[model samples]
Target chain A: MTAVAAPTRRRRQRRHISPVVWLFLLVPAAIEVGLVFWPALNSFYLSLTRWNGLGAPEQVGLDNFRELFSDGVFREALGNNVIWAVGFGGLSVAGGLALAVALNKPRRGVGVYRSAIYLPMVFSLAVTGLFWRVQYQPDGTVNTLLGAVGLESLERQWLADPKTALYAVLVAAVWRQVGYVMVLYLAGLKGTDPSLDDASAVDGASAWQRFWYVTWPQLRGVNTVVFAVTVIDSLRTFDIVWAMTQGGPYHSSELLSTYMFQQGFTFLNLGYASAVAVVIFALALLFIITYLVRTLKEEVS
Target chain B: MSAPAVTAPAPPAASPSTSHDRQRVRRRGWAFHAVMVPLTLLWVAPMAFVVLISIRGFDDIAARGTAALPDSFTFEGFRTAFGEGAMGEALWTSVQVTVPAVILSLLLASMAAFALSRYAIPGRRAILLVMLAGNLLPPQILLIPVSRITESLGIYDTLVGLVAIHVGFGLGFYTFVLHGFMRSIPSEVTEAARMDGAGAFAVYARIVMPLCRPSLAALGALATTWIFNDLIWAITVLRTQAKFPVTAALLNLQGGYVSNWNVVAAASIMAAIPTAIVFFAFQRHFVSGLLMGSAK
Candidate 1:
């Protein structure tokens, strides 16, 4: 800890800007600003215009925003995004926390179980999307298994039904996300001060009471991070939804990201898509700003 | 990946335990296994299905359906999938883009990370914030203008365009992780080198770079998986099927062979192999990197 403290003191006193610093920083800064920040800012400006990929830009201030509000598809997309954020984010985090708590202690074959649970996290969402899409077919594995288990009456067209399409996609998203959350929580659990657990155990506290009072409080940092990640991931979702449904069945599963893609590339409504992109950006920015402020404060302290 | 050693050593500081405590611990372990074993099986079942479908003949699948056990298994699907020639080209394209993107991004990010972590730069916190914010923004927001930029720069629909966007997009998260790792290094080592008249470049090259190998390796493994798995950028930037990465190509293959579930399954499984291999090989570092970045 003192090693880090000494560097801060030295950093404050050292005022000279080396030429090496410029050389090292220039290329990454150029790429980041040019490709990322510049384009992100340009998305805002593009939203206010009525330009396709070709032809001169025609300025149409706030028209796209107005159109977006009135657009039923966009509204559906927004509603689905909210549902996705809540459903996928909430379920995955809860599932992950549960898995983490279960696997926290050292036990035989725990590593194998951890690996099996995390295996889905490594696959591309494209593959997972396709895999689940097939499995959700009416005559697919899901229905077949249900029939074999004597639940034939409960089977439905999982992906084809508008009411269940977004939820079906959410199931796949959660499959991948839960593993990520579990890994993070497991690491957090390992780093926790076990003496606190032992002290509470000695105090005649029940197991659940010890965990809720002593353990969960220590995991506030992991919870914030997991929540932020879940929010951002839900907003950034595209590959799986696009690959599976293409936001179809009357745009029932249309997320903001997928909607942005449809408007810009598929429909050539670049301006309208940019507006959708802006909304996505705004939603992500809200959580990102909070996360950054908190993490940076931690860095400082 | 190396399996975590599973020695069940009791905590040294644990007080003398009664028989009741021993029974409780045993019960907890049993409960954990009872819950986790089935969940783990359920989680892996999807991919296992894909692998099974990929190996069976299309006729076998058509006759038996996807859920039933195959009457016979053959590599005919794999042969047809790979012999189509597009898979090979797409895999090459993926390699072409992912390799350069990972290398260039890591090079640039490590340099930036060293400067931010070691020096007394102006507005360092602001710069860090900017990088974090850039990473956190959804890529769809950049899709419109970035594609236009690539077009104007004459790199659109090319591997160069793909690599450039990947590097640019990857810079933030890589730098964030590398900076955190670099900051934890003891500064006295660098101070001594500086006192010995080593220039900043010399200090960075001879000192910081070597120290960053573990983090760099971790980021490299992760970045490769991400760039290879990317579909949105490939769909937005590349115009030709010939230049499509494996993920996009898999989507195309699925479209072209919609009725041929066996071929699509084979192609999808093939597309997934590289990342799976990378993940298993570097599982330890990858998990550590993720935990390091998120857990702070």
Candidate 2:
């Protein structure tokens, strides 16, 4: 015990290690500072100035804020984004959990279904965007099928209708995203105790009762993560919208992502774009922090 | 797509061979098949349409419309997409950016993760959370600032700049996942090697690294897909069209060539290839990696 204590005491000695470890640490940290932190600070500065990409930024100091408040387009996009968050974030999690719970059994050919469902997730967002575009065309397969079912009157330009376009995009988004969530929830489901399930089964519980009483509570930790992730993700979606309509005929499908990109790049309203970016940054941070706090509180209790 | 739902479990005591059990099983089977048929069709329709339209002759597209099925298939779209030299050029550009970006990010992130796991690093967990937090931030916020910073560094509008941008963005998440994996390994293995007179470098070279093979595989696959698929970032940061990777090149094709559905389908399918290949090749690891990291 004394000898072990002596080695432990010796562990406090200044062991002058080689510089490689510091080199490892500093390289990644330096890139973060340069690319992420430095620019984050610069974005804040640029947000206060009224400048295009090339000119010297004149400090307008919250004048941009005044203009942004009056901007009808920005408000419309903001409302669309909130709708987008609920549709994409809420639906995908519920769908994914339902799928994962359904397939948690050791069924034959389950892996085949899993792979087929996940296959779409492997497609590039650009491709998904294009694919959805094809499906949304006036004479596309979706309309054609609906026409065959004698719902031709219901067939409208899916992506052209401002009210329906974002939701149409959500269909494709859910197609790709649900597999990702399902796979995560499946893994979470794996961690649940089989005996508990068996005991519940022996206690004459129906499947719905078992799920509500046993499965959901056990899966809460995973659900918390999936919920936060989906919300952040839905808010940040860009490629799909950009590929599909670029915020579309009336800005009905406009998300903060597409709006910021257009403002920053095409319009060169860098300051305004930066402010939009900051809002997105804040919302994502809020979701992540809230989830983390909830999880941590659960741990403490 | 909803096949997971078709696999409802019943208690083992309720064997299906019993007549009543058989009746119930048969009913469930038919209901399962009925549900899956349409679901699978809905899921598979988009890809099928793209492929169907891509091979349709231009005359067929003109006569019927972009949505119409081909009377006879042709390779014209693929030929046009590849032969016109646009996609081919884009392919070269994508390879130039993606290969190096994926390799370098994985290498740097793994090395950093190794060091983070092995050493008594200061502010380790906090550093990891910062990285993870960056992952959640919308990439739109970083576009303008990152572009300016790269321009000041004299690499904006270049492929190396694109690679560096990817690395900077990717490092945090990759390092975070790899660190999580490393922490789960029992410390006794490292201690045992140390007691056998293994040096720090030797332990890493011989033990820790070999154990991290699965993680490296997952990271490489995921990073490849992300870099290959990324468009908005690459477009915002990279100005020169010649420097555009496949995604940007494909994106540009959309607005100017809205009427060219044949070409777009072909290009979109082409764009999905690298990711699909990487995905199927290492899918198990991909799922495991995502679940483990997200669970954290």
Candidate 3:
């Protein structure tokens, strides 16, 4: 019916938005545009000027970006962020997928198992960080377990040591994230057709082949959501790292977000922080834009 | 056989194959339990450790270290955290921020979603896509300017400012999800209402909203957890310790406690309880809402 009525409807409504539509859109658009989009756009302008919060911002053009490329700490921060993206994304996706697959089928205690798995996801990252800090202490469970297991050589100050701090923080973050990813994948799995699995099984396909061919194909939508979520998350990760290490032990775990916070709030280099923020914005946009474009194409058609 | 008029029972093929399938499933189930039991325990271990520490005395923890079995159990840590740590006030502050933010964001999002989905509205696609991308932008990107805006508005250090920011930041994702849901509602139903001379606002409030309850509930649960747990925005706009949300206050507690594991553990647990309750209460709706939104 829509296809049949398309032309007339399009011609009639193409440029004419009803007043009620405007009434509905006005407040949300105002809040979104005024608070979020406008400031975000202004951040770009701020990136080109130097300011210390007390004085008026002075125009410096691309100097901040130039300094960013050469600064050693910024380099370390950028590199750590890349590493974080890889480790956090890779582990959470893989682990979540595995758990989702395992728990997809309902059983006697599936709910209990799932709740336990997803329990960590509900904790605030600040809580997760502090909780993990206790676990990572020198005499904490981790080190104690290692000592009991005769792996004492492998135990050290997990958060205090620069070499292990980033990975230590990443582990805690992934612990919190994996369950969330699992829940998404589980929802996606619910939409898959069981008959397809049966058909593949009847054809004598292996479990791996059945999953790769039949099940995975049906999860395209969830994959899109998950990928966007993971990428954006890895880039913008702050609370856990901030709470756990503050990107500390010689800036070993410093992410772009934490570094930006440090630069803007701690040091008051508002311009350079905006520059870093712009970099984070650009990277996140580069990803989410691709997702938005795809979603838009689907919606339009 | 009672079915004498019926044909042969398909050579018993379905029966044998189904039983075979069941056997294989049973085996897989056993394997799953064997693996998942250990993994689940491992996942719960850190949480368990925190609870144990929270109940134990700080003197005991200091003397025996965090890994040792508890020698003393007391509610002193909880008392200290709630009173001296100021977590009790922060919890109330978090409630003030999260409840209003969640309600406002859901209201605005559903309204915008109803309009965008039901009407052509020029530039609708661009608006939706921009909001979608905006939701994904790192908060740090808007940190400096947003704080500046808050300061200039003289609402800095106010819960009202924090609530507004949450609603603003939350609008994009909430609208996107609600739009997906509202689009899935059959146009015929709304058209019938329109034929009855219901105005758009009437249709939205009476028709669209009631149908979007699952999605709204899901988003409400999610937005509550997110806004309650937000530390960055709280730290950014609000400076007074008295006004800090639970998460920000927990961070402060971590700082103040230093290596005092008992008090910190109690405070962390206090900070997490609200969201944990929300998560469990709405777990079903949350998953179903996400599934429905992505179903299209």
Tell me which of candidates 1 and 3 scores higher on DockQ: 1
Write the residue-wise lDDT of candidate 3 on B223-266 in tens digits.
88888889999999998998999999998988898877899999
Model 2 ranges with Cα > 4 A deviation:
A1-17, A291-301, B1-19, B192-200
**In candidate 1, what are the lDDT values of residues B169-191, reduced to their tens digit?**
98988898899989998988888
* Candidate 2 lDDT over residue span A1-301, tens digit each: 2667656533532262337766777788788777777787788788798889776888999887677778998888888899888888778888788878766775545676677777888887878988889888887878887888999898999999987898898888988998888888998899888788889988999979888898779988887888888888877799998888889878888988898999998998999998888778877888879666654464346
Model 3 CAPRI rating: acceptable
Q: Order the candidates by TM-score, highest first — what do you get?
A: 1, 3, 2
Return the DockQ of model 2: 0.49
Of 1 and 2, the candidate ahead on DockQ is 1
TM-score for model 2? Answer: 0.92
- A165: Cα error in model 2, Å: 2.0
DockQ values per model: 0.61, 0.49, 0.46
Best by DockQ: 1
Clashing pairs in 2: none
Residue pairs with backbone overlap in model 1: B1-B280
Error of 1 at A142 (Å): 0.5
lDDT at residue B230 of model 2 (Cα atoms):
88
* lDDT of candidate 2 at residue B46, scale 0 to 100: 83
